[model samples]
Each structure stands twice: as structure tokens, then as C-alpha cells.
Target: MRASIESEDRGNSMKEQIKYGDDVLEIELPDDIIVDRVAPASHGGAKACHSLRDDHAEDTYEYLYGKIHQALIHASTRIEKCGKIVIACDDNTRVTPVKQLVPPIIDFADARGIPAEIIIAGGSHRKMTRMEREKKFDKAIMDRVEIMDHEWKEEAVFSNVGTIHAGDESIPLLLNRIACNHDSFLMGIGNIVPHSVAGFSGGYKILLPGLSCEETVRWVHYLISKFPSEAILGIADNPVRRTINSVHQHRKIDLLVNTVLDGSSRVVSLCLGNPITAQAQGASISRRVHGVPVNTPGDIVITDSVPESVDFWVVAKAVTNTKAFTRKGGHLIVFGPCDEGLSPMHGDALKRMGYDAPRNIRSRVKGGDIPREFLLEASHACQVGEVMEHCHLHLVASGLDVDAMASIGLHVITPARASSFVRELIEITRNEVTGRKPRVKIIHRGAEILPLQ
Candidate 1:
């Protein structure tokens, strides 16, 4: 059920059409390039929130609040007398619907006479604007609770917890001072999905990259890059995740509430309990919903980035997820409308450190060539380099110009020119090889799907 060619469309100019958010991209393949398959979109039994709300009207808040209450009571040793609670939530870039979960959580804490505040886990990303904050939270909740943004660059706001020894090198675990010194309980809220680095999103990730200092974020990403095999899409338990969970031993994160959302961003399943335990349960549901099994690797795989894929930093996930299903020296083309360009915050860093091959970048980093300010940039460059080493990557995006694409080691193409460009490239490659047409595969919402081997 992974991919199938439409028998009726075999004779037509259009080979495939995919949904890219609210837009549709129609791909027309030339005679020389044969499309082997077009994968079906993964459906996770997701339903519209309004329908779910109506169906479970009497049980909605009761079911959700019960779970949240049980998790806090079971996980926290001082829930009865806890004074302050910090809820770490995803920012605008993530697909998580923070508004849905925050209101109920605030109500629960207020009833207990515990003061609760929300911190936007911006990580290395830019801070959310006031308008964005207003849109993300309900008016009632915003008026009562203090909403703060995490500032990764502010040194005074971070406190050193301890150091994690990863071989000879030790990584310091510096967290947001408010989060690290929470008077009572800490809760992390996020949606579980396939992640390129930490196997899956959510769990302590809401703490590490979500709330930790810039140095901690850089070290964690670098660690994941060191082990490519384990740190891949659709994976559940990996070294990167293990390292993040290890922090719980030193710093206590009481309760974690992770949800599995469908294509419409409706919650299909909700997990509550220990951070690692809840995340694992949520990931299990995500794998079944998003995992697509492929019989064999394709010579050329084209993916459409959707949802929040408005920047290269966000949309590059399509490249990471599809890398496993792509053959060596093959092509992986991502088509999207990246209106924000590379990234609002990290674009300059990515441009300065060109996407050299991973091996070369690693050598330079080990040799002390990459400055401290560019460490995170180097990690991103390393990931792009690693993907490029395996496949010839291309991007058909409107926001980034040709030079910007080339600067990051991506071949640029436009929606109008894609057909001819693909045909020409395939024809040349076919002639050099056995003159056999390249086997192509198309994935709709590629960033959201997890291709399983």
C-alpha cells in the first residue's frame, strides 16, 4: 500500500499530483523518466476536532483532565503542595496545537492554587512576536497566566545543571533558569512525530532543544550527527534520545503530555505519565499513522513539503526523512513554497558555512576551525552535507533565489521549469548508464510521512 501508478494516467502528461498544504503540485514526467510509483498518504484515523468534541461532549474534559491529573499526581512527589509550575510548549514552527492543551492545563493548576506560567520553547529559533503569541493562546488564558519566551542567547537566564560525559568530551547541560529552578513541578507539552535527529519529537526534547541553552542544543545536534544510522526518521529509541533522557536523572521533569495528531492536526491519541514513557507511547501511535513501508529504494524520489514548511530550516526535514528510501547517487527533490527563505534566525549562519561534505566539515570542526558562534550552523551544515553525500538534492522553492540555493549546495528549479529539467537530467543519466529509464517515486506531504524499510 506504499505506492501505485495510476493505470489511467499512464498515457497522460501528468504523472502525479501532490498536496502541499493548501496548494497542489502537479508533476509531469517526460517519456525518458518513468515513474515507478506514487505512494499513498498515510492516514492515522485522525478526525476533525469539532466532530470529536461533539461526539464526546460529556467526556471530553473529564477524560483529558483525568489523565493529566493522574500523570501529575503519579509523577510528582510534591504535587499536593507544589507552588509554581512551568509548562514548556512548542512555538509556531511546530505542528503542535498548543492552544488546545493550555486552557485545560491552566484551569487544572488554578484549581489547586498553584501558579502556572507558559514558556515558548523557541530554542535556537527566533522569538515569537506579540501577535503570534496572542493567536497561539486563548484570551482568557493569556489574561490570567504570564507567557514568556525562551532566550537562548541570554547567558544570565541560563543556569548550569551539570555535565554529561559522551566519550572524552563532556557536554554542559545549561537550562533556562526558571525551568531548572521550578519551585514544584515541570510539564512539557508537544505532539509526537517522526524526527530526523532524536528519533522522535516530544519527551525530554521539549526540554533539551526546546528549552535548553544554545550550547546544549549544538552539542546534542552534533551528537546525533555522529551516529547517522541511529539518528534517522521513524526510529523510536536512539542514542540521542537516551542522552536527552539522562538529564532527568539529574534534573527532574515531573509530567509529560504528548499527543498524536492526524493530517488535520486533530489529536488521535494522548499520552500522560513519565516523560520518556509517555513519549514512547505517543511515538508508537505515530509510527502506525505516519510510517509507510517501501519495498525497495527508488532512484529518484520527489517529496512535497507541507504544513509549517515555509523555511528551508523547517522544510529540510523532507530531505532527512526521505534519505533512507533513496538509492545511492540518486536524486531527492523537494518542492515547496518556502516564503521565509533559509530561516529567519539561522539563514546567515547556514550561508556563511557552506554545505561542504560531512567528512570535511567534521574534520574542520575537530581541527577547531569552526568558531563557537557558528557551532549550531556547523551542525546544520553537517546534516545537509550528510544527505548530499548520498543523493543529488534539489529544491523547487519560490522564496529562495538560485544563489541562495547554490550557497547551501542545492540545485534550484522552478515549478514551470521542473518538467524539462527533470527530463533532461534523466535522459543524460540514462544514456550514461544502461539507457534504462530511472525509477521515480513521489510522496505527498513527504515531511509528515515516515518511510520504513
Candidate 2:
């Protein structure tokens, strides 16, 4: 809604507009080559409970409250004591409509005579600003319900909830104190997307990286950093997901109100139930919404990390799913507008290791070349390195530290210069190649989809 997509023709050339932050990128492609693009698909935007699905009734809250009420009633059946409940919501880094859906949860709590509060499971991202909070929940909802952000780094607020073994490693599980409190019934709200971590985001993930302590978060990230991007990016079930589930079981989560979003981040489907079964059901719908089959590979592929575009570290997620879209020896461009620069938390960590191959980084970590504090981000760097090895990777990032990006092996181009650069590159590549027309495909909002064959 911020800006309209406009297209035009310049004699045997194609110009298309893509959104970057608030600015529109008017990229023109040489018509001599084959041009194709695909975004994440949307369902009819239905609501589901258990195995049942239905159209969005006018009384959306009734369906939400009914399922929640039934579950809560069932949970409280034998107990006489008045219990407390907590609704853990995802931050703006995800496309989840946490603000819109939270009020109804509060109403459900009130009706059940249980005190309720909302915790933003930000997962080590920057704290949400007062302005951001206001925009997220509006003033009325903020005043009506208690809302607070999870302090992942604040050691005082975390509790060591024992340890769990993932593969051969036994890791200490530290989680948010409030979330781990047995007195509070947990209701986690999030959106499901094909994720590099946790197989897909939702289910028990609201506890793992979402509300877990700093070290625990780092451990999970580093654990999966061992695998190549293609090995785990779009997979629905993987080692990392199983590990997260193992860690999540330490805390008791009753209900998971997970959603599936379209390319535009609209809630295309809503799922309600416990984290395990509900999440499995939810991811199936998410796959349908975000999965795009690709029989023909593209010579040039572009993707933008919409759900998390704050910095190069997070925005590089566009490269995760879209890697499959780029054919071997093709070009991949990622538009990452890093508003937070490199990272607010990891000081010079990514800069120190930069982005490189997985085997090299793993060896460096083993040899203690990378500081213990930076191992978490080193996993992310491995992803970028994996992309660089297969194809020519270009980053169209505006706020990245240019010198650091260069040193780290990223071919970064500013948004202002991206159009001309892409056009010239396409023309040059076309001139050099013969027999077959090269393919150009741009995936808008790449964070959600799995580009499947």
C-alpha cells in the first residue's frame, strides 16, 4: 500500500518495479533473454482447528475464542486453583499479525477468569521501540493488556531449565523465566514459513530461539550452521528442528495459534491447537502458501528478505530459499536494507570472520580462531559463504558497512545503482552466451517461500 507497482516497455526491454524498504526498484531486463518470476502463493485465507477448515466468518474472534476456551476449559477441568496464562507473540521481524490477534486472546483469558499478559518473543533482535510498540498493538490494546519484550541477553531474567542432549552434544537449556514458570499456561502466537532454522518457524520454535537465553540461542544457530544452506533451508523436518523440539519440551506450552502468510504477509490461514500436532498441521498449509515449484532454472534470480530486513545478518535469509532458483553458475542478487547496520548485539563478530565456506569456518571455529562470543553469527556467515561458492552473489544493501562487506566477500551494490548494474550484467551475460535464452526470475518477499523443483 505504500507504493504502487508500475511497469513499462523500452523497445525489446522489460521494466518492473520491486519494493525495497519504501523505495521502489525499477529494474529493466533485456528482452533477448527469457524472463519469468514467481512470488509466494496465498490460500483462500481460511481458519482451521484440528483437521477442520472453514471460511473466515465475520466473527473471527468467536472461532478463535471458542477453540481456546474449549482447550483452556479442558486444561482447567480437574484443577480448582485460579491459574495465570501468558500469550507469547512474535515481534515485527516476522510477518505475524500479533497485534490484531492478541486482543481476542486477552478477552478469552478474561472470560476464563485467568490473569493474562503478552510477551514479545523478540529472540535477540533489537528491542521494539515505544513507537514500534504503539504501531504494532495500537494504544487501546497496549493499555488493556500488559505487554513486555523478552530480554534474551539479560542474564538476570533467565532461568537454567536443566539440560538436553542434541546429537552428541549436551546443551544447557536456559529460557525466559516467565515462560518457564509452571503457574502460567503458555499460548504461543506466530506465523509459519520455510525457515533455515527450525525447519519451519512456528510450533516449539516460539520457545527455542524465540524466548530462549542468549547462549541457548547461539548453540542452536551454531548447531545448524554445520550444514549447507540447501541441505536445510526449505526442509520441513531436520536435525535443528528436532533439537529445538527437544529443548522446547523442557517448558510446557499448551496452545499454539500458528498462522501461514502469503507473499504480501497477509494471514492466509490460521491454525489452533497444541504446539506439536497443531504445528505439523500448520506447516502443511504453510508449504502450500509459500512453496513455488521451478522446473526451469534462472540465469539471474533476485530475492528480498521481507520478514526480517533490519540488517545484512538477518536480511540475507532471502538467499536461503532462493538459492534453488538460481541455476548452477548463475547470478543471485539479494536486496537487504540493513537499518541496524551490521548488528546491534554482535559487535564486529560478522566483520571478524566475514562470510565464507562452511568447511573453512567450521575448522576456524574448531581451532579457536573465532571468538566464543561470535560462533552464533558465524553460522549465518556460513550461509552467505555457501551461496558465494555456487554462483555469483550480489547484495543490494543500502545501510551495510561497505568496507566490511567488501572484506567479507560480498559483491554489494547500493539500491540507487542496482538497476543499471543488473541491466548491464544481463546484457553482457546474454552477449556472451548462445543457443539458449538466459532466464531472469525475481521473487518478491523471499522470506516465506521454498523454491522447489
Candidate 3:
């Protein structure tokens, strides 16, 4: 029921002309930019509780336009028709400037002799569906930007295949797929959260599902969260990581655009050029003001008082990764308000993991044992739901009493202990050990922390 579409009245203020050098050009944009950010219907509590406005919306748009415009200028004056302009984006928005707003603005610029074509940075993700694809372009600009025929280029890779043993079903990890196949070109990614695996943001993620297959998306998401190599760092050099990068290198990536988000998800800093290099610099800046350091010591660190405006996806990312900032023995304190634990697609993946009730628990207790593969399948499922709640429903519907956590390989800390209550948990953890060194790490990634952009 929130405002999914912005009206025209909100977009009318910027019709004037401006001069840069001797050439004068008019800036044109929809007065009200309608944004429809999707949140889970059943478990929207965590993200819904936070403020719902895009605090950095205006600045993000301006920066995006500026980058395209600058690139257009360079392409027009210096380069020729053979040149390409690629803009990398994610599911964050259906309305893209290049596909929706830029053509008209560029037409005005073209009056001043600048010409450019916007190509979808469909490097490594799935293509949008009919309905989802419609929001990206109007009739006119849709013609201007070229949509790649398909999302991924299928390629077979010879590697050690392993089975993700979820429940009883063992899914195989197979070959690699590349999204875009360009020899060499300039690349610019929009923005993303600072993840442990990719290190900061804006590498080749915008195209993940959009370019990769369903299984590919599943594998990448699963491994990034549960794998051990992440602790060592520079895991990008690993075989799986290198293979993914090789696909991008094949595209001849030249420049990278990365956006830094404040705790409030505002665009505080924008870094241009060199994806990895820019991300390192931008992420460092992001942490200085918004990142809460790991300083406290507790068996279970409960992050209470989370603001409502933060999305569950970002919330899950922050809490799930708390271990990275926490001492080994400590558990995480998640104050998530949502009851539904995973995204819709992610939930489906979890179900596919095959969590039938275990024989032992089915007869003795209400709960069931879930294999690690089920956990891996459901790892990214923690969008906002409690795993127990989801499991309970699944069990009752399927007429099963209990499940095992081991079979699925997912280690959920649900059936939350009574001691987990923030006040009690803190007291217990704090009081247990004598002369215990306080070493706790808390990251304020949710909406509570103000956005730096």
C-alpha cells in the first residue's frame, strides 16, 4: 500500500537550461521518478519497520546520469559508431536511466552532437521476464538500447564435480556460464552491498541470475555464504572464483563504477573505474562512518533496536556475516521482526533441498533433522522468516513431525533459546567467564545506521 509509483507533480522542478563550456544543453528527467522496490508480502516486517524512502534517490540518479553523460561525451567526440556503452545494474530498480530516462535526455545532448547507445550490462545474470522487462523501457528508448537475445552463453567446464547433499538428493555442480561475450569494452556497474565474497561491490554481480541459470544462481549464493575459504581472503584467486572472473575478462572490462551506501542505504560516495580497486577504496570509506566495529565479547551477540526501514535482505547479510566480525565462540543476535525467513525464490530453492522428517526425530520429538545440503539450499533463505516457523509449516503440511538440521547442512539457530532474550543473554554471556577479554564485533548494516551518501 506504500507509494509504488511517483506522480508527475514531483518531477517538474528541473526544466531549465545549463551551460558547460560554450555549449548549452537542457536537462530533462521525469519530475516524479516512480520506484517500486519489492519486499516480501508475508514477512515484510523487518524491512517494512524501517523508513521507506530512498534518502539518496536523487543523488543516485544524478550520479548515474552524470556517468552516462560523461561517457556519452567521450564516445561522441572521440570514439566512433563501433564503440559501445554498457551500464551495469541490478534488481534494485525496474526503471533504468539508460533504458528509460536517458534517450530523451541524450536526444537533447544529440542536438549538441553527442551520440551513444546504451547496452544492457547483461554480463552474468538472467534476462528479465515479460512483465519485469516491461518496466525497464518505454517504447522509444527500448528501441535504442539493445537487449541481448538470451541471458547466458552456455559453456561446459571440466572440473571436479561435487554433490550438494541436501536431504537425500545430491545436486551436482557443473560447468560455468558467461553472460556477455565481448572482446573488449568499457564496463560500469551500478551498486551493491559490501559482501564478504565479492569484497565491497560492483564487480560482475548485477548479471548473476539475469545471466546465469537457476542452478548457477543457487550454487553461487550457497557457496558465498557457507564456504570456508572466505576467511582466508583473496579467495577470488580460487578455481571457482577465477573461472567466474575469466568470463568477465573475456568481456574485456575496462572501468568499474561502485556506489558506497551509508547505514541508511543512501549513496554517500561513488567510485569510478577499476572494479576491484574502486571497491577497496569505496568500502574502506563506507566502514569509517557506518560500520560498527567488532569490539564486544559474548556467546550470543544480539543486535536489538534495528530500525524498520532496512530491508530483510540487507539485514540477513549483516547478521549472517556477523561471525566474520565476531569471536569464534560467539553466536549472533538477530533482531529481525519478519516471520517468513527467505525470499520467495530462495524458499523454493530450500524446498528443493529435500527436507523430509528424519526417522528418529519423527517418532520421538516434534522437530526434525535437516541435512547440510538443505541448509545450503536454504542458506540464502533467511530473508526474513524463522527457519523453525517455515519448518513447522512444512512438516504439518507434509504430515511429518520433526526434521534434522544435519541432513540439510544448514545450521539455523532457531528454536531460539529463552536465554537469547537480549537482556538475559547479555547478562549470562557477560557473567560466565572470569577475566574474560571483551572481543565482540557488531556491524550496523541495517537502516538504523544513517546512510553516508
On TM-score, the candidate that comes out on top is: 2
Q: What's model 3's overall lDDT? A: 0.37
Model 2, 86-197: lDDT tens per residue? 8888876776776557766677677767788888888878888888888777788888788988999899988898897655678899888888887777889888888887
> Which residue pairs in model 2 clash with each other?
none
Model 3 ranges off by over 4 Å? 1-68, 77-80, 83-86, 93-187, 208-210, 215-242, 274-293, 304-315, 337-341, 352-420, 434-443, 446-453
lDDT of each: 0.72, 0.75, 0.37
Stretches of candidate 1 off by over 4 Å are 1-9, 19-22, 30-66, 69-77, 229-231, 423-437
Models 1 onward score TM values of 0.87, 0.92, 0.51
> What is candidate 1's lDDT per residue for 322-428, written digit by digit as tens?
77667888888888777788888888877777788877888888888867667777777777778899988988777889876776577778777766666676666
- On lDDT, the leading prediction is 2
Q: What ordering of candidates by TM-score runs from best to worst?
A: 2, 1, 3
> Model 1 — which ten-residue stretch has the worst lDDT?
1-10
Name the regions of candidate 2 deviating beyond 4 angstroms.
1-11, 49-70, 73-82
Q: For residue 58, give model 3's deviation from the true position in Å.
A: 14
For 344-383, candidate 3 gives per-residue lDDT tens digits of: 2344444454333222212222242434334334434432
